[model samples]
Target: MASPTQDGVLEALRPIVDPDFGKSIVDLGFVKNLEIDGGRVRFDIELTTPACPVKEEFQRAARDRVSALPGVDEVQVTMTAQTRGRETPQGGEDLLPGVRNVIAVASGKGGVGKSTVAVNLALALRGTGATVGLMDADVYGPSLPLLTGVSGRPETRDKRILPHEGLGLKLMSMGFFLTDDSPVIWRGPMVHGLVRQFMSDVDWGELDYLIVDLPPGTGDAALTLTQQAPLSGAVIVTTANDLSLIDARKGLAMFEKVSVPVLGIVENMSYFVPPDLPDRKYYIFGQGGGARVAAEIGVDFLGEIPIDPRVVEGGDRGRPITLHAPDSPPAAALREIAGAVARKLVVLAERTPAIADANISWVTN
Candidate 1:
């Protein structure tokens, strides 16, 4: 009996079509690292986005197809996802070299837990086996160093800033450069320059997703990022309350004015669930305000994150709940929101024509 080969395996998988793009995984360049050891076979399927709805379906089909190949005794299939835009890069030293998708997590006002959402969301995406980076663009209030549980200034290597790594993520933040109590009071131009440097100077090699934590409000940071980064889309973070909702609308409008697609809205601190009463629910922030705002704005309502004390404790203690207490309510909620965000990326990538046109300006620079 003859053993199976890589070519034969590729041929078998060439027929598996991605539901979002209606193209075979092989033809779409999703298959990676095909290996054959006697009767055993293993390979990875890199989806266009981590939130692809047909992820499980694609995995099942690939395994079944490869297992049916000649002399195949065992088959293992791994799924990986990356965000892609329509614009193709020109040959040269690439800008943001190795970064596939950039997502800005923004808000219209402060104290809405935007940093917390950004940190947990990045961890959630990393859980899906895609390389992820969390860039803290909130110069005045960089919290990733504390949230990711890592503290120290980034190292310089060959003139490129090396991001601090911890909690299964690569992180860059102004927090790392300052003491916990120090303040960053810079002019508008300085702030813009720093944001630009973060994008062009950091050595984020080959990340599947770079989740940017933008400062609260539709101010200089948000405007600078919208005009500069090759963003796949923006995820607006809002709380369940009238004031927060009103500000969130401004954030949404800012993205719209800049032609940045609003992927969805995440309702952080949506409600409060007392630890003592597991079954009881409390309408602390006023119910359904986030969802209502999302509907009113005509963007996808990613999901709601109930207010939990652990979430606050985790952030203060430099331990994100998504990693420390994966089973907790807020942690689980973050994962769900992450999944929804991922799925929304797929929709944006497939359905939006602007992403393609926008890519041309950044990818070729």
Candidate 2:
């Protein structure tokens, strides 16, 4: 029997295409470190993100295809990721030079659990072995310190603020500097300066993902973030109800006006599954509002998160459900949403051209 040459192995895997990029894995340069000895075949399939939803499918397909070769007896497929990012030029005034992707988690209005969703999503992304950072960009109502149980003023050295570390994530928030009852009565310019400082003056280090929990509503803080932050994409968090959906549309329009891609809409509190009735889903906020809005607005419907009391309890205690109760239904849904967000960012990075300055142009309304 003839040995399987590198050319033959590459040909065998050419049929497996990346669903997002519409190109074969071989053609996309995902296959790496190929080594063949006797009947043992070993290679690594490097994906764009650690949180890729289809990585297992790629692994299975690669093993099956290579094992079918004439001289292949054992196939070892190692899955890896380099976490693709937008082509932001390094140095020269790039704010987040070391951060690859900056994701804004926003909502149309308050009371939609946007902070909860952002906390869990950041935890979920970090769970996948990606270096993640969570920035509470809600200058008026910074909740990350409460949600992640991280407090105390961030230390500064050489004029750069070092982000606080907690729950395996680099954390930054205005709440850390304020007392529980303190109010942020800053003007629009102050909010803008604080948001810009969070990006440029914070030492976030090298992170694969930086999840910014933007202030709810398309107001000054949101506008400033959309204009200054080199955001790769934005995720709109909304409840499955008319009121929330209305604000969700306004939020979507805000991102669109600034030329930022809306990764998708995540419907939080879509339904409630009672502990007694594990199988029954009570659609308390009406049915399919999120999907309806996504379809109506022509964006991806990421997924729905069920209303679980534990999610709130955990957040209140600085333990997001995604980190503490990962096997729970709500946690699973949040992780799925995180995966979708990661995948959508990869798609945008692949389709969009690299810009010299990552900061988007401000559109006057």
Candidate 3:
């Protein structure tokens, strides 16, 4: 039997292409640290995001391809990721210099569980071993401190405000600055200043993702964030109802107007699954409104998060469902949504010539 040469191995894996990139893994230079000894083969397949949904498929394909080699007796395919970032025009001087992607989680209006979705989404991303930060951009109603159980004024180091750490995530929120009864009665300029301070004056060091929970609506705070923040993408959270979907469309329009890509729409509380009846679904807020709106607007329908009581309880206690009850249906749905968001960002990054050039490692023929 002949030994499998490096060129032969590359050829074997060339047929396995990334669905998002529409190119061969070998051509994209995803196969790394390849080593061959006798009949055994070993290599790592590095992806753009740790939360890639197709990682398992890639791993299976690579293992099967390499194991089929004539001289290969064993195959070791390690899946890894180095999160890619959108290219900032300012480069290293950008406010979020260490943060790769800034994702805004917004809603059409309040009372749609947007903050809950944001908290759990950040937690889900962090669960995937990605360094994540959560910024409650809702100046009027900051929820990060309450949702993550992180409170008190954040300490300042030198000239930068240190983001409070909780639930394995770096967090910043106006909630930390106010007492429980304090109301933010600031004007538009003050709101803008606070949002800018959160971006530039905070020390959010080296994060794969920074999930910004934008205040519900297309008002001053939301508009300010969309304009000022170097947002990679936005996810609009809405309930599966007509009124909520209406606001979702407005929120979607806001991001579009700012030239920020809307990654997709996440339907929170899409259905109610009673604890007693685990197998049954109750469509308390009508049905399929989220999907219909996404289709009408030409955006992706990320997924639906079923209404779980634990979702509220977890947030109230500063323990998001994705963290405390990770195996529950709602938690699973949030994880799926997070993965979809990560994949969408990758697609968007690939579409941008500057970001694509900076992130992709192309193999020469």
Candidate 4:
């Protein structure tokens, strides 16, 4: 029989819905087991994806929602991810084993500074004492070579591709294979295979974060990476420009189909202030576009980075802004955002208390 508080706990959660699935977790039978004593509540929750970020969120929400119950004291939610995947037609998660965390930086449209955001953010994460890797998934326009300043062909040993070191990062890109001035073209499946090979054949080593700078707009590369990598989360990069917002929406939807949690949204090139006039602000791409999209998607708006010319110079010279001018505005913003993102990833690995079931007691007095 259910106590008043136990029933009240369930009653409070009757309206919570999964952000991606749009179904109530309780109705989905994700609330596996429940027990109540005195005022504490303990339960096991299951998810359609073992690594779904919402697994923790649901628990936290449950805890908060149930704490309002008449006699509740504590809430314990043990979440387990179960593979309930239906075959995703194109961009569903087909994670390569052993990949720690893959974070893709994407944009809704070109010229919105998505690539710049990716490079700087990757550098910022490195600053936080984590081993990081950058995959130039934008094969046709591999900017990492230009940004990282590694031009020679990547050497191969043991038949596995060795990533080039740039701005203190391990890198793999098509630009390494092409001359600095060469133009290249690729077919669909061929390009897809290349993305796959980069992941399977490279020696990524023990990386804490793998920042993948995806091509502008949702396309083959975006879909391919989603299917090939065990991505922990993604960051949608966009400007405050209307066109960019449209593109950002497409990218967000692409990741959604594959069950990828959008860690947050990043507004890049958010503001441009002239050198002479520090106080005057220029809304070059319009204001609040990125924040608006973030709200619309129900994701955390990590932060906005001002357009810094130093960033372009750094990328052009094979030095990322975070490395060249760690004190610069954009670099500082990236560092903060990077650290926050890393913390968000770890939050998914919530620790379960090891208390023996028989050793617990509830006080009703």
Candidate 5:
């Protein structure tokens, strides 16, 4: 085994790139120091700015990289703030109360299974032993109640909107407020205010994950989530259809402009299956459009879910596909997506979040 030296350590640090600057800390002057003594490694990680929330992350990455070197025995990492300017405004250190990791599931166009992904992802996250909440921010089309199978209006306690429940998930949706006969037709600010109230006035109660289902398009609703509060991240839903990918790009660009990280993209309806004949996938739309978009944007291609009638049937039945067919191909895809998202949140917590779990105060005892 080669001896642990500063040069070898520096070589190992080359790939740990900063998300804000897109450069290696070793080359970008963020790595403050490197000390190696008989396989014991101690390093100081200095961020480009003092407002860096990812300090812990850079430290962890450095430890992992250096610890993998030929003769490293123990690793000690320290983080110090040193920067050229303000850190990237990807949300901030202080997060919303009673909401730990808030992820918005969005799409460019409707009928692309955005809410389905939101419902199943939240459920799957719960499957990982994390308490989760689902909020339907789609005022024009609040389908969470339909998907999660919770109905009736949310009651109020001291003017706080009570959230509903769905198979190990706490939930809120516009459907719980308005009747099927009524319609919501306000502009951007109004839509934004309604969502803000959902965040502020609802009794979300201690959640490790709060999955928000937003209406399709890069419209007022999407703008509200990006502008009103700090979001953990966003997942863009797409399909193998080129048009959907194009729309997904618009939504992705919105997050980039707001400095929020794109967690990844989900390819829904990637294939098709029949009840009688199961071994065939009819590429009814196109092929690999979501994967291509993820590659182009340099983000993770979480995975794909086949277009099964069961998916829609499950929704109509108020049961997510993940709940019924826990091992089916589509459910497996959603679970993989939920897992990918769960891991990314851990990284995001190091970068911009200080609290491990938010929305604890609102949890029902």
Candidate 6:
């Protein structure tokens, strides 16, 4: 028996609609490189985002559809994702030419461990064998220097700045430029310039994910990032407290106003466990507040991070908990949250192609 034609394979996959584009995969240009050799069939599905949510569903649908054809002995499916606008920033220049996805980690207020989550999330992504970068956009209170244990100013070659490297991830932050513990007294415009410079000036090479540590609140730096850079989406970090949730909603609303999708909410410092009495759980900050807020706002509850003293020590020592204590409960939780956030980003990336469309204007310079 002879194998089916490539056209027949595509015809079978016509019913599979890409969840993000609201059109058939065939129409969306997702189905590609269809090849059939005797009883073997193979093809690739090119997705809009690496964090695509319906990846599994699409694979199953495509495999089953192709295998159902006559004389089909085995069906092989491969998926590859890429972003269209990452090379172009708002200034009509290619900033991060090799980067694929940009994720902003923001919070409604400070003191909620936002930087900690960002640092560890970057490390976890690196653990998954993907190239990653961590940028501390918290100009006023840049703590990535402390969290990642990287100090000193970045070097420049040929006028392009190189990011400080640590924990197997490239990094850029205003923290490296400041001295002592003094505050940055810049005006709104200055802050905006710093954000733009961070995105444009840094030489962040091809990255699977660039996790941005945004300044807390829905204020200047946050506004600058959403407008100046090409972000895949934002992740809201909040504690398990009523007031935190109240402020988190504002942060979520800010992203919505700019048309940047909120990937999900992460409840930080959700609980604690006593080392001596290892069996007991302590609700230190409160409970269910983050999940409730996510439900109220119609977003995903990514997961929770427990209040662990070691998390603080790790930060102080310049090693993220995810890398310092990979076996601890908090480390396990952080890794899980990182994976969830990554997956959601892929899904949101496909759904919100307009975000890339809005800010991305390719310039042939």
Highest lDDT against the true fold, candidate: 2
Candidate 3 lDDT over 1-365, as tens digits, reads 87788888889999999988899999998999999888888899999999987889999999998888899898999999999877755323466778889999988888888899888889899988899999998887888877888999999999999999999999999988896686868788898788889989999999999999998889887887877777888998888764455676788788877668899988888898888888888999888888888998888999999988888888889899988798899999999999989988987887784742332221000
List TM-score per model, in order.
0.81, 0.94, 0.93, 0.68, 0.69, 0.77
Q: Deviation in angstroms for 265 in model 6?
A: 1.7
By TM-score, how accurate is candidate 5? Answer: 0.69
- lDDT of each residue in 88-163, candidate 5, tens digit only: 2333332346666778888888888899999999888787666788888887788877787788988899998878
How would you encode candidate 1's per-residue C-alpha lDDT over 1-365 as one tens digit per residue? Answer: 68999889999999998765678889888999888899999889987776576789989999999889889999999988656653434542345767767889998777788899999999998987778999999887888877877888789999999988888899999888886595768788888788878878999887878899998888776787776777778999887774355676787888886677888888888777788887776878777777788888788888888888888888888888887788888898898888777766775776775565655554344
What lDDT would each prediction earn against the true structure?
0.81, 0.87, 0.85, 0.71, 0.75, 0.80
Q: What are the candidates' C-alpha RMSDs? A: 4.2, 2.2, 4.7, 12.3, 9.2, 4.5
Q: Which 10 consecutive residues of model 5 have the lowest summed lDDT?
A: 356-365
Residue 305 of model 6 has an lDDT of 83
Whole-model lDDT, candidate 4? 0.71
Q: After superposition, how far is residue 223 of candidate 5 from its true place, in Å?
A: 0.7
lDDT of 5: 0.75
Candidate 5 global Cα RMSD: 9.2
- Clash tally for model 2: 0
Q: In candidate 6, what are the lDDT values of residues 1-365, reduced to their tens digit?
A: 87799888999999999765578998888888888889999999987655455778999999999999999999999987654333334445555567777889998888888999999989887876668999999877899888888889889988888999888999998989987887779788898778777877888978888999988888777777776667777888888863455676788788776667788889888888888876677887677778888998888898888888889888999988987788877898888887777766655555555555554542221
lDDT of 4 by residue, 54-122 (tens): 556788888788877777777888877543211212332233334456788877676777778788777
- What order do you get sorting by TM-score, best first? 2, 3, 1, 6, 5, 4
Better of 4 and 5 by lDDT: 5
